[model samples]
Target: MKLQDSVIAITGGGQGLGRAMAEYLAARGARLALIDLVPEKLEAAAEACKAAGGDARAYTCNVAREADVEATFASIIEDFGQLNGVINNAGILRDGLMIKARDGEISKRMTLAEWQAVIDVNMTGVFLCGREAATKMIENGDKGVIINISSISRAGNMGQSNYSAAKAGVAALVPVWAKELSRYGIRAMGIAPGFIETEMTASMKPEALEKMSAGIPLKRMGKPEEIASAAAFIIENDYMSGRMIEVDGALRL
Candidate 1:
């Protein structure tokens, strides 16, 4: 679809990859409904979008909650008059080894709560928002695109049983949703990012960052804008659906 005049809703648009995408899409002339947990951050992003010459608004939402997602969409429809697309970009990280033992005795294992928390936001949150957006698209009878933000961790990473499982589910959901939604003229896709230099990675120790980058064949971490660029491409290109575009710089990790 054309970026100009398109109504695009983004979850977690306050910061990180979400914020970057909001800025990019806004610059391209899309009207935005940016949803995030932090109202202040959303406000800040809204200001930036305005500065970039785009029509934009912000909504504070906990994407993992059904009430919040539904309410946010209601507000979006009220404000934008129509909803054409969505980016399920809200996610969280809670990493831990599933099993840790010394001398064969189990010393540590991932807690169910830890596992559930990540899954709730990363996996289930995607489902809720994607479903809501698809329904709206169908109801409006508008051709739409839904982009789910998956991660390279979906390939199975150490010390991230919860995150890995959740991400893997996200990747799987892309194809399933594509099949189901195709009949309605809606498309679903996923982006599995690898080693992006965002706030989370910046917090890691310098040596640790070096060690991680060493694994990437390009010897570098990806930028949020890189992922945003990929997203823009997917949304504009109608033939691309049920696919997971890896944004990693040849990084196995």
Candidate 2:
């Protein structure tokens, strides 16, 4: 699909990968509806997109909430007159081991709250946003694309039972949504990035970051723009769907 003048909705558009994608898409002439939980961040992102020469608007919405997702999409359609695509980029990390013991004594374990929180945002949030986007597109008879953000941790990482499970589910949704939405001329795809240089990874200690990068074949973290480029490719390539593009610099863990 041509991105010029197309209306694209991006969740978690305030920062990191989402912000990069919004700016990239905006530069390509796509109108944007940037969604985020923080109003200030949403405003800032929208401004940046506008500066990139695209019509952009900001909406504060929690992707994990059904009401918020539905309402936000409705508002987007109302504002843009049509919704052409959606990027399910909103996610959170609550990494922890399932169990932890010290010297034969139980110390701690991953709490149900941590597990549920990650699942709610990473997994359920995608479902809610994708469903609403598909519904709107089918109703309007608009051929569209849905890009979901998965992670290298989907392959399973230690100390991230919750995050790993949620990301794995995200990867699975690509093929399932593709098959289910093909009849509507809507394509579903995923991008699983590994150790991207985003705010999430910036919090790591310097030594830890160095060690992580050393393990990757590229010996460095990926830039957010690289992942944004993948999204653009999927959006423009009419035949691409039902698969994931890994932008992890050949990192496997």
Q: Per-residue lDDT of 2-50 in model 1, one digit per residue for the tens?
A: 8888899999999988989999988999888999999999999998887
TM-scores for all predictions: 0.97, 0.98
In candidate 2, list every pair of residues with a backbone clash.
none
Candidate 2: clashing residue pairs, number: 0
User: Which candidate should be chosen as best, given TM-score against the real structure?
Assistant: 2
Model 2: residues with Cα > 4 Å off, grouped in runs = none
Poorest 10 consecutive residues of model 1 by lDDT?
Answer: 133-142
Q: Which candidate wins on lDDT?
A: 2
Model 2: per-residue Cα lDDT over 94-164, one tens digit each: 87779999988989999999999999999999999999999999988889999999999898899999889
